[model samples]
Target: MLSHVEVTARVALTSVAHFVWSNRLEYAHDCFVCRRVGRTVSLHPNAENGLCHSSERRLEWQDDIDVAGAHPAPIRVTGFDTAGDETSQRLRCRLAFWWSPFFDLKRPDERASELSEKRWVRLHYRVGCHVCRDAGHDDWFGPQNSVQSNQVWPVTSSCQRCDTELVTVAGPPEINLVG
Candidate 1:
């Protein structure tokens, strides 16, 4: 059984991931902080946070908009341009299936084996990038190219437009457990 905190974290993380993936806000969007800064927002999926280049703002999973808003802020993985680490995290088995030999079942052996393999492992990763939304540059990062699950955030990145070094820290997200 998972502790209350762990369970809440998992639920929040899943909900945020679902929201981000569904909205496709992992790319060029207005930064949650300085709404004036319009550029590529880096989303660290595994870390459950991201950083915006416009202001070098770090976004967390728990960051929320007001109740009157129709949607929550966008979630993204930072530095999706570069490769990140992948790790396995185990998930609890919630269902129990009893295989009865006498029952007429199609591929009973396969069904039993499938149910028996309830212990699951999920891959987590992390990445980082500078939020350079220069109108001329096309270096945009998104979920498919950038998101990492269960890994540390990148330490350094350069603004694609200004070439200035940006220090990035994988800030602890409200939701710690991904799987």
Candidate 2:
């Protein structure tokens, strides 16, 4: 078994979501209901094809977006294409800071204050599952990538079924390298 490897990197919070999607890195998040690993369980009761697209396993994005102050930025989602295999394509969505809403605490005033504040946030790509206490399987986590990969994630979430608060892995400190 490969020992747990922790690599750190500095990334602007705004760009972290794009970075993860572009790199095709594997990330493991627990089921909001049973605490089962994202890759190992399906939350949808109607799901029959073994394809899970819910937030329990994926970070879905809205239809329209504003990037760099550009209104209605045409965001595109490009999935992993297996050469000559159209049916095998893997769809991964890029998440942005706006995906997680943050209120402007500084300005309680209604008219003058900005509605939300967007800032770079620190996140951790858990190398393994804390509940299972196993690190033997690489697929249990997100895709493995080079050290330059940028990684960021939603700060808080809840299991849709059980409503249990989901917790992500803690981030690396004082390290400018990303894994």
Candidate 3:
């Protein structure tokens, strides 16, 4: 049998290969309601948030005119753009699926020093509780279901909003590039 160091080195080297090897992951945050891109400002006095209704008026902007006021700050929607096509999408989906906290094993870096380690890993999952699941998202694929989140090894967590324990489990072995 290999010594502990030999085993650790092997695991570390292998886990690195499991990472999605892409240079082109781009992130975006826009208003989910209006699809208004962020980093921009309204050009005119519009319903506290709607586009200016100041078109050369057959009617006119009333002093007390009512319109659907958008959120004081637009509700930020998020998405990413992959540089490559189908292959990249597949790779991303694979990596995302394994990002869950493992139930039985310590994170690879703790067991294998050869692996480069970070203080935290970015993950996007939700505490499956009605209180935490935004205002509306109940079942699956809700905007709040996968908010910006993270985890560390020896994974332990409580709902950020609810203080309930989150159950996490390891799935099939992470995909590795051994060949």
The top-ranked prediction according to TM-score is 3
Scored by lDDT, model 3 comes in at: 0.23
Alpha carbon deviation, residue 170, candidate 2 (Å) = 3.0
Worst 10 residues of 2 by lDDT: 112-121
Error of 2 at 78 (Å): 17
Candidate 3, run of 10 with poorest lDDT: 2-11
Off by over 4 Å in 1: 1-132, 140-154, 157-167, 171-179
* Candidate 1 lDDT score relative to the true structure: 0.27
| TM-score per candidate | 0.20, 0.18, 0.22
Candidate 3 colliding pairs: none
- Per-residue lDDT of model 1, residues 2-110, tens digit only: 1111111111121111111221222233323333222233333343543434433323331232223223233433222211222211222111111222211332342
Q: Write the per-residue lDDT of candidate 3 for residues 77-120, one digit (tens) a residue.
A: 12222233321112121111001122212222322211112111
Count of steric clashes across candidates, in order: 14, 10, 0
lDDT of each: 0.27, 0.23, 0.23
Off by over 4 Å in 2: 1-65, 68-156, 171-179
